[model samples]
Target: MAGVYDPSVQQLRSLLTLAEELHFGRAAARLYLTQPALSLQISTLERRLGVRLFTRTSRRVEVTPVGRALLPLVRNIVGATDELRDAALSSLAEGGGLRLRVGLTDCATALGATRRVIAGLTTRHPALEIDFRVVDLVEQVTGLATGRIDAAFVYLPVAEDFHIQPLTTEARVACLSSTDPLSQRASVCLADLADRPMVSLTPQVPRAVRDFWSVDPRPDGVPVRYTAHEVSRVESLLSAVSFDGARAFLPAVAAELYPRPDVRYLPVTDLPPCTFAIAWPEADGDAPHLALLADVCRALRDEGLPTDPPAPSPRTDPDASVASLAERQ
Candidate 1:
């Protein structure tokens, strides 16, 4: 327990928001508070909890191990609080108090298209209460299929049952510790990481999902090693790569969305690219709001897909399915 020091719901939301933004200024803006105020809240939160929730420096901020493990629970609390707050509101102009809940598989990713589409939706229907719920990968699929979620952005290799829209298929990049020898190179091939142990996902993950992420069936026929550490959260996995002697293969989008001083993302020359898509069930195909979302997606994607690494690739981006984390662990 936190003793007699109790934090308000808004304070907790501030913690969640800051963890998502990973920047004091941006997180403050989102909460409509000044930078100093946000700093105070975070400091107080850390002091009260007796744990350092985030690591910060002049260049970047990152969630600490404790913070990553606590996120799923924190998110659940925040959602319940928001739902209660909304129920107390008597009226809305357009949405009439109806909540459009969209499930996100990622907790912290700055995706461009996701931002624009959400922005467009807000501009067009300000009255609609959009609850962007961060959940696990299985939940992302199950939630949509069962109507627990209005829609979701999921990575490729998913079941064919859902109506899907191809978003991005970017090259897979190698994630390594900044201090590792390979980090000195600008680019790397899969062979370079043959000896490094990789962070493992939860055991329940399907074999296909595991194989794709682990780069199983290597071109060189080299087997991979697994670290003792297993993570379901992206932050935790990144932490492993940074502090532990581990390596991973992730979508190229990570180079930007998750810039870290202790980690280096090098494009892998030999691995195949992974795809991400926005999906919904056939049952919701005719929903009015979903129709608007579909139209917005088409227009925005046609303009161009997200090109990651600040380098020109055919199509890429944290921009496409920033939801790639969908906790696809």
Candidate 2:
């Protein structure tokens, strides 16, 4: 008995290309092979299969009935082979070690929890390398979309195309100058700030986000007045409030992270809390390690170990679960 012969992927690839082009020269050019080489591959494939695959005339080339029948099968094989190759390459990359590029906004990095999250992630995946980039609020979205960063820790109300995993939600506070009378109050409301000059962020920040931070309209339906200063960085915004007698709203964590003798953070009693989340491209949401990172964040939050000193209980804690906060609102 004779042994069976298996066709090589290179031969099948040649056959597939030839079937699509139906021109020996064109197929050869596409495959980066000489016409004779392509012809030899087709001939070899036909000989092994014991079937004729093409009918060649001086004018044109046509696939024989057998060739037509095998065309779809060959295409499927090639597609599957390519998928296998890609999977193998991915596995190799993971085995050798993988790097995740993460973006962080100024406020996000200011969180003590952010550092702990990164530390936990590294401990969990010893083979993983992290590349952290600092991006501003508006640039975080663009960075994820452009593949400049794989993931980011950012505030909520971003583009709908991103997949957001909420990490923490904290109460918002008003940043005011120590000289301001409002600074004496334990807490303040949007109505109290209705006539005050609020520091406006640059136009690059989304209008909705800016509106929310500016506390756009007083609870009584009056528009919050804007100061002449338009700033971009957190330091600049704080400086404007500290020296210019302007006011701005920030996440409560900002109060803890950036304490200044000249600035006071009074809780905005009636306003909703600011939600911080991990955002990634919706397309790559399920890619390996992202879920693990989210899990680590959740664990850290649950343990109350996210802050510098770590809160003792959820009741006394300033941080709350993203899901629970959303549910309440």
Candidate topping lDDT: 2
Note the clash tally of each candidate: 2, 0
Per-residue lDDT of 94-168 in model 1, one digit per residue for the tens?
645455677776622344545666776676556667889886756776687678898787666656677776555
For model 2, how does the per-residue alpha-carbon lDDT over 1-329 read when each residue is reduced to its tens digit? Answer: 45456888778988887887899987875565689999999999999989999999989999999899998998898778867754554454468566789999777876655667788777655566788999876678778889999999887778788886665566677788888887776666788886678898888777877887886766688867888776767788999998899999877667656778788777666887777778888888666656556545544543444212222122222222111212111
RMSD of each: 19.8, 17.9
lDDT (Cα atoms) of all candidates against the true structure? 0.68, 0.73
Q: Residue 119 in model 1: shift from native, Å?
A: 2.5
**Clashing pairs for predicted structure model 1, backbone only:** 105-326, 306-316
TM-score of each: 0.57, 0.60
